[model samples]
Target: MAQKSIRYNYFLNIFRIGFGILAGLFTMPYINRVIGVEGLGKVEYVNSIIAYFVLFSALGIPMYGIRETANRRDNLKEKSKLVIELLSILFVTSLVSYLIIFFVIINIHSLLDLKPLIVIMSSTIFFSNIGIEWFYQGIEDQRYITIRFIIVRIISLILLFLLVKEPKDYLNYGIIVVLSSVGGNIFNILYLKKHLSFKGFTIKDLNFKRHLKPILTIFVASISVSIYVQLDVLMLGSLKGSTSVGYYVMANKLIRFTIIFIVTLGSVLLPRLSYLISNDKEQYVVYVKKSLNYFLIIAFPFTVIFLTLAEDFTLLLGGQEFLPSIITMKILSPIIIIVSIAYFIGYLILYPQGKENIYTIAVIISAIISVIANFFLIPILGHIGAAIIAVSSELVGVLIMILLYYKELSKLELISVNILYYIIASFIMFLTIFFISYFNIDPLVNIVISSILGFLSFFLFLFIMKEEIFLSIVLDLKSRLNQN
Candidate 1:
């Protein structure tokens, strides 16, 4: 297999995420108006509930498998044995997860009403196991992953618009959402033979016990993270009814959509970092430093723009029915920076270094704080409280991660002086966009004009300042273009 440059992988990932944003821009407003808040809320409510089962079925394999597979990427025989063992484990966990989903739906009175939707969405659990996306990610196969995703996403979007014509069609919307999210996974098995094989691997060669401790450790951390992440939706549905969940979902989705760009580098580098940890420690450190710098440069600007233009974005994406989500979006805007720093530290640093136990501890503490805060806050403040807790909880997790690993993190010089440059540029960009907001214009047109001027002004200022990172990127793109 051929290896791609980090720049190439990053481009593919960005393209993939960019297409998703385009799809959402087209679909969200349509879905929001067609389904209305309560109807959309009902689908989200069930989706949130089903996400727990999906999380458990994963059993942390998504993270653990990628690291473990990258470690053996050069040795196909060993990789095959490892993947087989992990799949066997995954099969059992997924079966158990689905069974539990079935049991809960029948046993719980409230869920009975959602039984049909729950069952429809539950197909994701089975598809996830077959996806084996970890193997391709381990080998850094960005081309296949990106292509498959775009194809499935396009199909899913077409289906969503066609089938989900009204509020009552929310069930159709639920199934379409599930397919859009995980449908690409179904193609993974078809592509497996080129990279993975079970030929020389015997059942007895598998050592499931060897993986249990680490997998369980990561699994616990995942559960903790989900508490603060997914539990807000679940709790909102339980306390304030599905309508509140709907509002929070809109804001949360919008915020998370932007976060995909911030975290794209981390996802691309996870396998690379895992590989470098054992083979090239010096380059690994360099990549970590560069990764953090890149994260901050993008995160700062994105946070400022989103904060200033939250209303335009909410109106543009979700329309007037979701106007309430604008405040939530503003409150959650800073999460782009928070999550960027945390992702670099946790996924790029600790997990690759086999320090997930430490990562687990950080998130567990954050989860405890989040749960206590949500219980007291959600009833009084509703979606706003959830938004506040979401930011604070993530901030707490990142703080603990930094504090616990301060001695190690300090030596890397993750905080670059270029941060000052990025901050100044973002400030200039914010002024540009903020000024544009006062002019009378259509929301979509305002966003277009604001984004164009804002980014041009941003880069114009950075160029004037002669920022090293920006210059390096410009030179790198020029070099690539010249070579081509």
Candidate 2:
């Protein structure tokens, strides 16, 4: 029954992520028109810088706390204790982050133009700490968090469409985004109290120092991960400038949201996987292989879309000025597969089992390679260079995970023939999309047609293959719903 509830919540969270993406999809074209390339680029550049401080404030607590809390969910007192302890650490690190941000703004010569937005965006660090989403996630209570996402995002979406009307309102757009994050996190506090109360809990309950070792280990791993996530944008902003950042971020605005739907499956499964690691190893292995197969099902087709409709997508979403993003999207599309598998290895398989060092090593080496590649590439190729390095770095990370976890993979039965099925399915979809593109119609109509045909092809292929993992999920979900 417990596992069934988690699965149902996972489905709900999937819808939440999908709807949130759709809302952003609705908002993006309008915002891109109002902000234009340079204005949007400037907003992204500052947010990229602020992303560092956000990581600092978060300090790996989200993952660490989730694992720790999930492991101790039976002990309400202990779960509450962990939340308080983690939040206390988040407060200190957030303060440090703010101090550092202030120092950076004062001393940095290049960031003067972005200073005000930098300060404005950095507010996420503080508000996000109060949000303590880690607290909600740790206890495996996704209901309210998903609800919070819908309410706040819809509100932000309304505010965005209503207020952001011109290029001059770029800062206003930034404010809306930042405040939405802050407000959402603030709302997290209310939902958190309902799940894990701290009525008798006091400072004495928190072993802040005890958490630092594990939390900081995860924090370092997170910093390494941030290399691919945030550093690429910062490097582009620094070496290539805001217009380049704008084009790259425009791809990110679409691609990252697409990634979210698949990735949240991993997020929803992590705590459950953690629970399985200690109590149900067989279940753990079964879940791992199935989830990964599901990812390949989704990732393959999305990569094809990016490659086939790159031009149409760029023209429609970002307007003609961002045609450069067409190439960037194509360069970066392979990451769809690379990141999904890598995330499975790093987060679902390793972190839940307390294999932080291996995970950290993989991310760190990838981060180092990313830094080297960006330094060498960003100056010459700009966003194109950044995109190439991002994809390559992710590929390298996935390879390292595969190599390092080969024995584990064999034990988990990770090698499945279903991979070939997924490829065949995706290839069929790609061929359909490729054929649809030859019509030479309007880009908008082309995207709509290609997407519909491509999705239908993928679905048909999955059905034809009788894909076991995909079908089991569908059947189980239906069975569970019917029982309810």
At residue 159, candidate 1 shows an lDDT of 95
Instruction: Please give, for residues 1-484, the per-residue lDDT of candidate 1 as tens digits.
Output: 7889998999999899999988987888899889999998989888888888888988889999999988998898998888888889989999899889888988999888888999998888888788888888888999999999999999998898789898999999988988888878978887788887788767788889999999899999999998999989999999999889989998888788878877766789999999999999999998998888788878887788779888888888788788989999899999999999888888999999999988899999999999999999999999999999999999999999999999999988877668888888888999999888889688889888998899888888888888877889999989989999
* Regions of candidate 1 where Cα sits further than 4 Å from its true position: none
RMSD of 2: 1.9
For residue 109, model 1's alpha carbon misses the true position, in angstroms, by 1.1
Instruction: Provide the lDDT at 273 for model 1.
Output: 95
- TM-score for every candidate vs. truth? 0.98, 0.96
How does each model score on lDDT?
A: 0.89, 0.83
Clashing pairs in 2: none
Q: Root-mean-square deviation of each candidate, in angstroms?
A: 1.2, 1.9
Per TM-score, the best of the predicted structures is: 1
